[model samples]
Target: MKRTFHHSLPAFITIIFALCAVILAGNAISLYNNLLSLRNTNSWIEHSWDVKDRLKNVNVLIMDAESSLRGYYLSGNKTYLGPWLTAQKKIEPEFKAMAELLKDNPVQSKNLVELKALFDKKIQLMKEGLAAFNDGGLEQIVMLAKTGEGRSTMDEIRLQVVVMESEENALLAARSGRFYQRYQIAVAVGMAINIMALLVLVLFYQLIARSFFKRLAAEGELKASNEHLEARVLARTEQLSILSRHLINVSEQEKAKLARELHDELGSNLTVLAMDISMVTEKLRPTEPELAERLQRASATIKTTIGLKRRIIENLRPSVLDTMGLAASLMEQASEFEKISSLQVNTDISDEFDKIDPSSAIALFRVAQEALTNIAKYAQATQVWISLRAADQGLRLLIADDGIGITAEALKKSKSHGVIGMRERMLLLGGNLTVTAAANGRGTVIDAYLPFNPAAQADASVAG
Candidate 1:
């Protein structure tokens, strides 16, 4: 259950985070749309106000023209013409502006057109009344006013202005309502987004807290289990290490003993048997040819057996290793490998370790020996380089092969006991061994470092 939750927790967190991101993004887009709509509504409201103001101005100007014309007819004063001419000049642009404004609304546009026609008629009547006063005095003006055409036209213009104002008022109300709606929606979206953010944060925090508490509860148990397992593993490894070291010592002793016995007993016996067979063959050869031939065959067989025994002794414990030291033994091994494997063996042997520790010496030799054997069997190389040298008050033996490089995966999967045995030998002697790719990246290099002071076995600090 714990493992399943641990595996599933990341997916859960990812989904929550994705949801939060989407919510925030959606809120932003909604807010932008609301603001845009609100701005458009506001502009429309201002436009309605402008159109209503222009319509009122048109009505007021037409009224001013009619009033001025009546005052001028009554007083025959040129000063009354000032406001009449101003109204006449102003109402045209005013009507033009209103027409431009109402062009989008068919109903308001028709009303504005009627209003313009009425204002034009009122101006024409005003002009005619002035002309009548100039031509026939007060009687002509009275005659024009009595017909009541000017009064009716003025009334129609007022009515048209009222109609357009009513339309603008209705449009303004609708736009204002829509703006309020968009504003409320924007406010609600903002609040919802904020609330969602708070909830997400609270949920995330609670999840983290719960997970932390659960992990804290299990931490002690996990630590105890790990400690117990590690203690057992450490104890088992120590025992195995002791057994391995003892076994290697015992094996070396047994091999040395067997080699001595073979040399002393079997070698002497075989030499005596060969000597007796040779003497009998010469003596009894002419007397009995068949017997002599049997004697010669037996002598040859005995000689072959002696040679085999000698080789076995040499392999068990090389005499040069005991007498000439590590370097000579390693070179002999290298020279022998070169002959047997038909591969190039370049040597850089040092005489610095002539009086080295026997245990250390054998460990180094075994590492080289094992590595060279692996190279012959597995490396399929054409050339090998062997180096035994002193480095940082310790012995460093390096062997490299220009063969297919070793891979980390191959090392992990390899089950070669020679590698294990060589490692164990070095660990027993406070030394370290490493196998790596060659510097040129096309081969394998083996490095073995044995510290003179066994306690100072830091891996690479004093190693070459």
Candidate 2:
């Protein structure tokens, strides 16, 4: 069994491991997909940030150009002219950079190109007006500046740049939303996998534990059953031995009673008759005066014979037991024992004896007899108590003595088959017997409990 369990354990563990492997494989696939999605999302974000940075630089250049134009219009300083020319040179390259960055987006690229063309026209007009001012044509320059054509051009360029920036912002928003959605999906899938794995592991663990406990319980039950069977067999063998010994004892007792009757009763009677005949012959032969004394001796011998015969009959089978039932017989026996042994005997017999079967009555009486006899011989007891009563589902008999108690070692030895015999009888009758030290460790108490079916007894009564 141990080897079988060991082999089966590995198989069970392997089954659990296989389940975990499947779960891990599924999670790994999800992880791979999530990684791919994340990488794509990161690339999109980096492209959007680069476009936004280029747009920022373009807006800065437009601001510097506008500031320089306003300065030149107010003071017409050549120092402001340097900044305006530098801003002018920067515009084309910045617009071209913005256009290239938005090449993947047609709408944003078109807007960038339109803004660049508008800014170029505005720069050409400003250059023509500045060349006129440098050649002493101040009136034309004033006319161009006052008509606000430069401001109108700046406005159109700004509107196109704003349109291009709006397109880039929309692209960034869309990519961000996709990235967030993918991240949430990955997280949800991972959580689901983990939860499923945990549930499976928990269920498998419970199954294994339940299986282990079930096997353990079966093993324990088998062990207990074997022990119980062995005990029952030993008890049966001991009971047969005790029965054989009891039968022998009963036969010897009967023979002893018969021999005593023959010797004490019939032998005495014949001896007295022979003596009377001898006395008569002597008296007749010599006319003896002692014939009267001899006749009285014969009469006394006849009385002794009658008493011996009565005793023998009582010993063979007490009439008191048949007439008054078990309780009275037990009381009489106890009284006789007390008288013979000079020990005090106390008894409490319930009036429910009529409720007991005759067989059960006999068994209980014999058990009491044996127990008390043992007490008389070995207990050195000053007092003994016997009780009989009805209990739930059974009748109970208690025999206790205030004497030297039985030792634990003595109880274990089973050398005295007397107690074992009593226990076996009770067990065969579907009853139980217990022997324990009396209260206060003063002596020993023996209790026997026997159950009977009142209905069965009633049926027997009707049959009888």
Candidate 3:
């Protein structure tokens, strides 16, 4: 069955988190913009109030100056002129402050300029009234005031204040409306995002729960399968071990039978031939001397043939391994190898080696024979050292040579049956075989170890 959230689950989860983050970021931006809008609205409301205050101050100062000028003209007292002078100085500054407050609005700023010009004309008219009253009498001042320039200027200033204040109020309303809308949008988006996030979290937890249960079920099945497989492997290994033992026993029995045939059947025939020739030689000696000499040579040749057959039988199945023991068989084999190969063969056999089981002794003897054979064929050594000892509750056989060392490739080659057979023999005896370069970077060393007792009889195991 296909898995529910198979390979793409992680990617799906990552995309969900990314969407949540984006929602949160968008909501945060909305809230920030709303906050800025509210701040701007508040600033514009404050500005409107400031512009009104400046306009009110300007009107009050103009009225005060007009009243002071009239009083000064009526009583002809310079003390009444002090308020007029003070109002003249203050009104211009008030107008300047109002212009600065409304500078962002071009229409309001332009209105302020017109208002300033009108104030200047009103101030000039008031000053002219005072100067006329001082230079002549109240008549010129009355004449100037009757022209209604002061009233016209006050009216124009009132109109400009109303216009600028109206513009400011409109701006405040618009900004407030935008702020409210932005706040509503932010709140709506935030609530929607929070609901989406809750749903995503629920789905994530569901996926995790499902995955956990699936893993738990899979683990149970895997453990059961492993136990079954292990049982099968153990059964197969036991069968192989039994089969190997049977084959080795059968091979050994055949070898012993062949050796017996060669020793008895072939050896008897050659002995009979030698006896007949010797008898003929004695009879021919009385008749023909040359014929008798030829018979003697034939008899000698038959003896040599019988000796060769005996040696071949002994090599096939050495009787010394059973009668004289493992140490004697190894030493005899080494001496024979030396004779055949004309290479020096050194032997060192510990007395404890003879105390091992007969089967173990036989396996070790065969391994030694195989090692010497390989050395004779491949080592090209001038001298070989063969040693047997008892150590670690087992027997160790070490055969070392001084010649060209064995290469890794040669050791791993499939055709190296001599080395493989030696190893199999040791394994059948519940032992191990290791071949390596000699200690002094010289030729090969074949080290074999067998338990003091052979495990079981197995002919194929011995040669596998």
User: Which one is best on lDDT?
Assistant: 1
Model 2, 253-348: lDDT tens digits are 675577566666566755777577666756655565576566556567666666666656554555565567777877887887788789899999
Alpha carbon lDDT at 225, candidate 1: 95
Error of 1 at 454 (Å): 7.2
RMSD value for candidate 1: 49.9
Query: Over the stretch 1-464, how does candidate 1's per-residue lDDT look in tens digits?
Result: 45533545587688888988988898879878987887898789889989988887877787787788776875577888888899988998998898888888898888888878888888888888888899999889878878989888878877877888888898888878878887887889888887887778677787769878889989988999999999999999999889988899898889889999989977997899899999999999999999999999989989999988987887788788888888999989989889889999999998656567667776787788789889998997999999998887788999999999888878776685776677778888778788899989988998888878543333322442
Per-model CA lDDT versus the true structure: 0.84, 0.76, 0.80
What's the lDDT of the predicted structure labeled candidate 1?
A: 0.84
lDDT of 3 at 388: 90
TM-score list, all predictions:
0.47, 0.39, 0.49
Query: Which is better, 2 or 3, measured by lDDT?
Result: 3
- Give the per-residue lDDT digits (tens) of candidate 3, residues 1-464: 87665665588778888987887887688778877877887787888888877877887888888888776765467787787889877887787788678778898888888878878887887777777877878667667668887677778877876886687778778877877887787788888887887777677888768878999999999999999999999999988877876786677778889999877766886788788888889998989989999889878877888878778877778888767777888888888889989999888987545546656776787788887778878778999999998778688899999988799998899998888888877887688999999878999889998775443324423632
| Candidate 3 ranges beyond 4 A from true positions | 1-226, 288-294, 454-464
Over 4 Å off, model 1? 1-236, 453-464
TM-score of 3: 0.49
